[model samples]
Target: MFEAMIDPTAGPSATAAGPPRAGRPERLDGLVVGLVANPKKNAEPFLDAVGELLAAEHGTAGVVRTRKTSITDPIPPATLDELVRRCDVVLIGVGDCGSCSAAAVADGIAFEGAGVPAAVICTDAFRVSADAMARLQGSPGYAYVTTAHPLAPLDADAVRERARLALPELVELLTSAVPVAAR
Candidate 1:
């Protein structure tokens, strides 16, 4: 497939290696959850579940969850800029689809360049083996979830409701999710 052909190239890494390394500012107090949902049947479910999961994982700091307008296209520049300005971390849903995965990676790069610290690009766990997922996770740069663990395996209504309830927690987790290695 074309995705297999396009080298991952470590799309986005955690902040930067080592101590604050000068230039970049320290992490932020509040974090905005950037949910890059691919336009797909399952995108809503995955994103909703992620919002809920993050909230449950963290707390209410800040959140800016959104979905891509199109599955084939990268996020709009304005949206990307706004996401960077408003969020410290981002999570892109791979939705068990290759095209969605690629779009997530692209969006991640844009967010990273905008100064977002960590970007979690979710991929299909079933499609890619656990070992491959681990390799992607261990890659020099970029934060990845290759396990194909969809945040929402259940119904969309349940996922969205759950996300709404956990929005606060998600915001908190995004701030705390800083890679310990970076610190």
Candidate 2:
């Protein structure tokens, strides 16, 4: 007779996809924009570029901008609250701030608690190099994830052009789960 061995440590393997989510799908709408920047200087440039693209290409209704002063720090709760209150959708640019970008995903979750649609923007390198960055970072808290391929070394014009090309997809993805009128 043989008995199956039971390992106490045996369980489901940890995955990069992070957590499982289930809920009613939401729809996108034209409302307000929440622009977030990482601690890097280029973050602002990226945010500005996306904002312009969203406005010009997507016809975003309004705009709100916020940036984290330090990469190690979370976006301030007060600021997140303001963003939740002010905007229907938020576009958060992580730049090269990979870890900080992950944390920002958590911040987006916090904003979602207050009812705001949010997206975290990062260079494709980070997403492609570490596909788990968004997955492991994103929890049930955030609205969605938007990965953008930035021009190498953070070229402003290139980023702007890329934003123009990608903003529509980001807008559609971010707001896909949450309606503009809900907030």
Candidate 3:
């Protein structure tokens, strides 16, 4: 008998036609940012820290957010629409484990499909996994930022530290290479 193994964590994936990669918005100056909280325990706080950094350092205008009730569930269409409508760019948080990482990258692809610039956050250990997900989703070489691993197990201070360390890359991904016209 042969037993085949499958990645139990794989969820829905994205297709190549889903979205064309758009250039970044020209400036964070007065740009509204959408922060996606994937309902992982520490994701919200970590994302919040990143948002704060953006606000202080990049002069971002505002941040809107949505928290998924579960990591495995798809982000509601309404939530995606809201973020797309109100925000110039989006920052999705904490693609830590397998399924969550895949889901987060999928969400990033979805935003890209909507013509929004998005960056998914993954822990250092899962960076490879998240990139693989991006490739599988048809948005190979997709943008994402990496924080230290095991966010759920961290204290607030530790989480903040990781977020702080990740802030530069986060800004780099969000602001770099954006078309001036898109701003």
Candidate 4:
């Protein structure tokens, strides 16, 4: 019975072809930031704080917030299209668990493929799952931000602190123009 169990993370038999990663912008000034949040505990507040920081310090024009239907599901194509059309750069996150980490990474890849720079935030503990999902999505070595582990247990203030700590990497991911090969 134990041998019959399959390891889903063993690696995909064939990687799905994803879109070309979008080029990063030189700056965030007057750019519209998009925030995609899963329904996990503290995810929204964390994103809210990040959005606030971007608006206050980065000269972002505004923010558009959206919620995913489930942590394990991908963002619908239509919603992804809408975000690509409306946002200059997008931030997605709160991937504190395995499934959600994969999903969040997938979401970030999707946004990048659609020609929007995306920053994915996940807990450091789930970095393996996130990296696996990136490879499964044909985006191996995709860059994302990681906060301290056990993010779901954090209170509002704690979550905000994590967001603040994560802000620098998030900004770099969104604004740096490193070639995809280097990522």
Candidate 5:
């Protein structure tokens, strides 16, 4: 008897549909930075440190922060709308795990589609997941920042250090007209 085989590693059924990515600002100075934290361990402090760095080093006017209710889901439409309305540039992250990493990338793509430049932050361990998510969202080769892995166990100072390490790439994503694909 002969048997048929199936391939399970196919891509997503549909890619994301929307307008092109938003135009990046020339600089972060005087721009309102938005922070969207997923429901992951240590996400808030990580993003808070990033926000502080943006303010001190890049001269961002202020920051508006929010938390998503789920780690494996896209940002709620209302929250997305609010961020787009209020922020000039946004950072979404702390994607330390598989599901959260995908969701965070999706959120970043959504913001980009809505005319807001976005930088997504994730752990090094989840880069594959983040890349797959970006491709699925029709943003193949999209750029995002990654810090060292195992973010959940880090203390406040360590998390801040990770944020500090990721700041340059984050700044580049928000301020440059050219998109730097993730390596």
Candidate 6:
């Protein structure tokens, strides 16, 4: 008797449709939520509030938050690795300015490639930049939520308001694969 075999490495169908994604869990309940913030003004406070809400509404187990050293740079590899290791889903925030938003999108791409789910948050002012970064990363229409523009100068209460206004969008991005909205 003879048997025939085929190599597993042969076709387009064998490849993934898009960038790698950490498997999305069925429930956010009791999952450790991570927040990675760009260190632009007001960025930390905004993420802190968002963390509070995620815990309140999502049954999140715990929060782990960190910030990139600069707004326009990729997070250090060590930090990125730690985030992937420690959290179930990461909410990335305050891609508020041009360079900063681009950097956030880039980080999102990297996180996806590393098998960690990440939601990129940018302000309306830099949607174009975020879109461009997504294209550069080969997920051109990747969806990210937009808050009102000019996040840097807002006071704590105003930033909290913006964070509040952005919660629904945040939840949507965190839960689903949204296509880029028409500008």
Q: In terms of TM-score, which candidate is strongest?
A: 5
Candidate 1 matches the true fold with a TM-score of 0.57
Runs of candidate 2 exceeding 4 Å displacement: 1-30, 128-152, 178-183
| Candidate 4 lDDT over residue span 7-46, tens digit each | 3365653646766778888989899999999999999899
Clashing pairs in 4: none
lDDT of 5 at 160: 91
Listing every candidate in turn, what is its Cα RMSD in Å to the true structure after a full C-alpha superposition? 6.8, 10.3, 5.8, 4.5, 6.2, 10.5
**Candidate 2 structure quality by residue, lDDT tens digits, 41-133:** 567777788777667766767688877776545577788878877887777766454555555555554555456656666565554312333
Note the Cα lDDT for every prediction shown. 0.51, 0.57, 0.77, 0.84, 0.86, 0.76
Instruction: Please state the error at residue 132 of candidate 3 in Å.
Output: 2.7
How well is each residue in 91-130 modelled by candidate 1, as lDDT tens digits? 6655355545655655554555566654444444433322
TM-score of 2: 0.68
Q: lDDT winner between 1 and 4, please give it.
A: 4
> Mind sharing the TM-score for model 3?
0.85
Q: What are the clash counts of all predictions, listed in order?
A: 13, 2, 1, 0, 0, 0
Off by over 4 Å in 6: 1-18, 177-183
Q: In model 2, what lDDT does residue 97 have?
A: 47
lDDT of candidate 3 over 5-83, digit per residue (tens) = 2232453344354478656866787999999998788999998998898899889998997897767555778999989
My TM-score estimates for the predictions, one after another, are 0.57, 0.68, 0.85, 0.89, 0.90, 0.84
lDDT of 5 at 22: 87
List runs of model 1 lying over 4 Å from the truth. Answer: 1-29, 125-141, 149-183
1-183 per-residue lDDT for model 6 (tens digits): 212111112221233345855556656779887899987998889888888887888788998999877776677789989988998888887988887887787777778878777778888989888877766656667767788898899999999888888877676666665443522
